[model samples]
Target: MQNKTRYFIILLILVPVCFSADILLGSTHIPFSIFVDMLRGIEIDETWRIIITELRLPRAIVAVFVGIALPISGLLMQTFFRNPLADPYVLGISTGASLGVALFSLGGGLGMVAIISNFGFASSWGLIIAACLGALMVMLLVVTIAPKVYDTTSLLIIGIMLGSVTSAVVSVLQFFSNPNELHAFLMWTFGSFSGLGWTEIIIMACFIVPLLIISFTMQKPLNALLLGENYAQGLGVRISLLRFQIIIVASLLAGVVTAFTGPIGFIGIAVPHIARMVFKTTNHKTLIAASILIGCNLLLLCDMISQLPGFQSSLPINTVTAMFGAPIVIFVILKGRKSRLHYS
Candidate 1:
């Protein structure tokens, strides 16, 4: 308990450090002294001010939230499915969001445009709504099917099949789309933290914060789940209800992030495992807190790297996260296999 508490405090302290670093180091360098002055309410260069406020600040904020959302969702999915490999991408939620965006942006249908415009949304808002609806559709489907399946593995396979189908649809839409629309859609898939501003952040917070609060309350039940479904059920945990809540929370968390950032890969799958290993416990209470803090730091670090500070060009946020996360996932799988071999 003491070590865990100490680790938590360390994580909390790193939050500001990572956030500050993320904001400070970017394509256009702002010296630490100037950054301090700006933070201290002293006037700074107008160009630097714009760079700090308009560019880096929003992306940093988005990175923090994306980091929190992905790992938490991954944690929930991993616990529910009892599979280390379970995540939004594995369960089709991210692909569903992608399908939604592709349908709206690349569908090239005037009817969809007319319908969205009637709601008084500009193009960006329409795209966001489309992604949300797409995710919601998949969530409903997954929830509806979850009860019918006898095994978690079967449910996981269903999710993969759904993702495959959505990917095919997205490909079809891309083929038929105009060159400009195709390019725009492709850029969105590359994933970014840069384009989002305050409005999008507020929207994400509204969904994420409430759901996150609700998730913390599930700690006891989630811990029960770690002991196995039979044991959890014996402990009076409502298996079906718990599964429903987990699916809903995980889908919405992943869906909202995907809508804003475009399917950030590997973070969802990798971060929860990182949290579990770091904490050395399956208790959701510690795991949840650890995942949130670690997720924020990791994503901010990835965002900083994606900016390619000394270069004129930046890599995609998704690319940097994948490079960081994929190896961790490989290590985890190899370690699991090695442990099994040792036991056998």
Candidate 2:
């Protein structure tokens, strides 16, 4: 308890530090004095304000929330399934997000205007709704049939097959899209933090804060389940009910992140493993905090790298995440390591 509490405090401090570094240390090299002045109500040139607020601020804010959402969702899924490889998006969440964007690119522009005007922010919720619904449909199908299958590996393979099918469909959409639309769509898929603004950032925050709170609330049940599903039920966990909560929370986390950031591939898988290595515990309480800290810091590192001039043009943000995320995932698999109880 003492160690978990100490680590949580450390993590809370780390988020602000990572965020400050991201805002202050960009390519233009605005010194700390000017950066402080700019943020502290001193008026600079319109260019600086515009650059800071319009471009960099949105990217930084979105980076933080997207950073929080994915890994936490991945953490929930991994715990629920007792399989380190299970990510919220592993069940076609990313594919559903891709197909939503693809369909919107073809028929309407982002579809934000259509969904809104009537629904307000609730309508503004469509991207996540599309993603959640798609993920839910897949989940429903899996649960319905998983009873007969008896083997968990088969369920996992079925999910992979579903993902492959969605990928193929997305490819077909890409094949027919015109050059400009194709370029736009391709850029979205590559995933840059450049385009989102304050409104989107606010919405991402609205969902993420609540979702994190819910995940914390479920920590006890999650810890019990870490002992395996049978043992969790012996401890009075209502298995079906808990599974539903985990799935919903995990899907919401993945859907919101995917909607705004495009399919960021590796954070969901890599950050949980990193957290496990850091905290050396299975308690979702501490693991959650560590995962959020590491996820935000790691993304900040990736974001800084994205702005580098080493490349003629910047590499996409998703590309950078995968470059780091993939190797860590492979290492975790090869090591075949697992979790440990945070408390007796």
- Residue 136 in model 1: shift from native, Å? 0.8
The lDDT values for all models are 0.87, 0.75
Predicted candidate 1: what Cα RMSD to the true structure? 2.9
Of candidate 2, the 10-residue stretch with the lowest lDDT total is: 113-122
Off by over 4 Å in 2: 1-11, 106-152, 309-313, 337-344
Candidate 1's C-alpha runs over 4 A off are 109-123, 341-344
> Which residue pairs clash in candidate 1?
none
Q: Compare the candidates by lDDT and give the number of the best one.
A: 1
lDDT of 2: 0.75
Steric clash pairs (candidate 2): none
Per residue, candidate 2 scores C-alpha lDDT tens digits across 1-344 of 68767776887787778776777666676567767888688988787778788877788888888778889998997887678888877767677777766655532333332322233221235544554555556566655655666445676677678878877877876776667666766776787776677887887888899999999899999999988779989999998778778877887788778777778888998999989887788788888878888888888778878877344466789889989999988888767744322211
- Candidate 2, residue 238: Cα displacement in angstroms equals 0.7
Location of the lowest summed lDDT over 10 successive residues in candidate 1: 114-123
